[model samples]
Target: MQKGSFIGIDFGTTNTSVVRVFNDEHGYKTVNLGEGGDYPFSSIVAIPRQNGGSLKFGRDIKNHREELSSDYEIFTSMKSFLGTNKEFKVGDHRYSATEITTLFLKYIKDYISRTHPDVDLSKAGLSFPVDFSPEARRELRTAAENAGIKVNSFLSESTAAYFANRKAGQAFSKVMVLDWGGGTFDISILELKKNSITETAVFGERVGGDDIDFALAKRVHAEIIKKSEVYNPVAFEDMNLASKDYLISWCEKAKIEISNTEDDYESAIYNYGMYGTKSITVSVNLFNGVVEPIIKSRIRKAVDAALGRANLKPASIDAIVIVGGSSNLASYEEAITNIFKDSQVILPDKPQWSTAEGAALMQIIGGNFKLNNSLGLYLSDGSIFPILKEGEHGVGSVIETLSFSLTEDTQDAHFNFANEDGVMFERATIPTKGYLNEIIRLSARIDDDQIARIQLYNNSMGDLQHSKPTNVEVNKLTFYYDISGLK
Candidate 1:
């Protein structure tokens, strides 16, 4: 935990996991925090500030809810909303998403400091969703830094999952990673030739286990209505209602337990409400029928979309790796087999812990390797405007933003993908032409490849660049900017 500690912090949508790398005489090894010793910390954050009490972290908030003040507040799914650059309200006061996120991360930092007092996490790789925009990427790093955690380069969650799978005797030159976690779902296509791994294409949705839990809760609520005549709908309708939401938390737990042993029919799932008078009972068959179809549909579409982007078919894929907590469902496993019949489907040793583990390993293995090419914008007059400059940047790199409008009727909008030395390799034609003054957005991305690919609909935008250990240059790098749509 000294020089190049190479730790990974997967600040996930629902749960946060950490992994520290170790090396000595026997080469390199990884220790996933949750699976190795103590349990992984939950991303669920609680504060009694709304109730005039002190802040609580991790197990204190989760296990001792009954002891909390009556007007206490807890927040989950912060990762999902962070991308929107919005603020969340707890009680009557509103706080920016970044502020609350920093608060949560500070707790994580304290946890690591207490547990591994000697370890320093200044070079840890931070994992974020593949579809995160440039602003979202910056936001995540800023929050982590504010929390007293030093973040070294970023890793796409799915790519990190790939490294974790490959380390465990997986022998696929080409693999697809199905990263379905608590609040996000990403399908990434990676091609590994020899030792180098590259993320060729990726697709993701802003939905995951948290969404599934809400879906199942809706189904359970309906069942409760049908069974008990004395049930009241008032509790479920209020957004300020914490007890009902707490009941939904119980439903989330039941979803996980049943997902692990889905074949069992002897046990029933139930979340009792208000002195155990009214409750909802769910069966395994119900679980599969209600939520499995949703998982199957989204996952199938994501996998197909990713493969299609890479210009490959299911047969071309050697193996499909499934990771994250939600992916452990027997139904999802069955769905993978049904869709990718030719490809070998691989499950992780600890499905939920792979991202953090692989990220830690990746920090040591592929330190500054670029995943994709840098993007440049070229005008019809043969002038090149480097949108995303082709070079690795500093830790506090400021990603530039450029916007262009279709001032006149134009036919050609060429995009050049190039390397660091003004060498262009690939060109893309954004053949968009219409009325004058039509503004096109350039929401820069450093994460997910596409939500809608090749439809003239850019879900997000990004570039890939490598870094070096030496700090010759600070965050004062300049870009060849042409913010206007003119030549």
Candidate 2:
């Protein structure tokens, strides 16, 4: 109920957290939102099988999981499937990822309203993974709006974590953020000046703690069958949904235990109908063997790629900030430390809540979003005609009537788009027939939604006499740029 308060929502894949921030005499203060001040609860939604039953979310689902039985259908990691054609069904009703997300967000809104009735939910910032497609980003915004929450801004997860951990008045020319969460791994290289933070490069993949949990569950299942006296025990893949879910939950707990303990950890599933009681001790070596491939192939590769794109060496990075639940793994920490031995590595006390807190902080201190890649046209002579240079402009800006001419008569004009490194990422073609020296006007803009739009017009003929250029084969291109910084 604080005046000028804004909320920051980190709607994560496995869990969700909300933080409320408002200015005070000192500066800004943040309050975590949840029942009993829990802040982050599970990002789970459950639908009851019985008719006319209410949908359950987060803590409600976790606390009553045992009673769910066959009467409820549970869904998690819905964030990963947003903007896709994937759907979840409850009885005869089918729900899209956006719909499920809306329901979950509405739950959070209602929960906060109970304690802070005067809090304005409209002014809020949301965090998302850097690798989320344009469609996914749009869908997330739609879901928030549908839930009656106005999204003031969208910040990438790694950037939010950086804002959360960064010290006031501290400056670092080059900092790397390694965010390994439940459903996504994101790496971002940022440049921090006095009051501005700019992202130089970012890389991400759809692999994280959830993946490790599933893999570990399978391994434990195999070990249990081998040690059991019953011949031809049920295969892990053939197990019932409830049994599988239970095993996965156990494995997730064991993964955390293994990370915190040096000794071999015992994982168990007890009194689960046909599964009975089974326990397996997992050695650190075994756990490492199972997760090393993911670490090397996805996590390590993403870090190297981000650094390469930013044209920075490990030693040049002043600090490395590690955040997210999966980052707690000892092996991941060790891998990061080894890779950047010269750089200072920092692990915040509450990595899980960092993104939400940082997002809230962003709402208090405004930031600007800039392009991390250059948008240009590839000329006929194999030369690049730059339209909008990287980091040259911030959002809500436009460039109109930038003049260009065809070098030769052609049926179509090809426009190639590349990142800052000159590696092509997209190509667009506009159909037109014009002689050499004919004028072509190009317009480019970055909207408030962080979408870059480019348009090409055929101004070859003397069409400037009219109110606008002559319309021939007009071509338009659009792409999302996921980078934000302080103003």
Tell me, by lDDT, which candidate is best.
2
| Candidate whose TM-score is highest | 2
Q: What is the lDDT of residue 269 in candidate 2?
A: 65
Off by over 4 Å in 2: 1-3, 168-171, 229-234, 261-264, 271-274, 367-369, 390-392, 400-411, 432-442, 455-487
For model 2, the run of ten residues with the poorest summed lDDT: 471-480
lDDT over C-alpha atoms for residue 276 of model 1: 37
TM-score for all models, in order of appearance: 0.75, 0.87
| Ten contiguous residues minimizing lDDT sum, candidate 1 | 467-476
Model 1 residue 138 lDDT score = 68
Query: Per-residue lDDT for 282-399 in model 2, tens only?
Result: 8888889889888998888888878887788898898999999788898899899999998888888878888888777766655455565666666666666677666676566688
Model 2's TM-score against the true structure: 0.87
Q: Mark the regions of model 1 whose C-alpha exceeds 4 Å error after superposition.
A: 1-3, 35-37, 50-52, 66-69, 230-240, 263-276, 371-374, 378-487
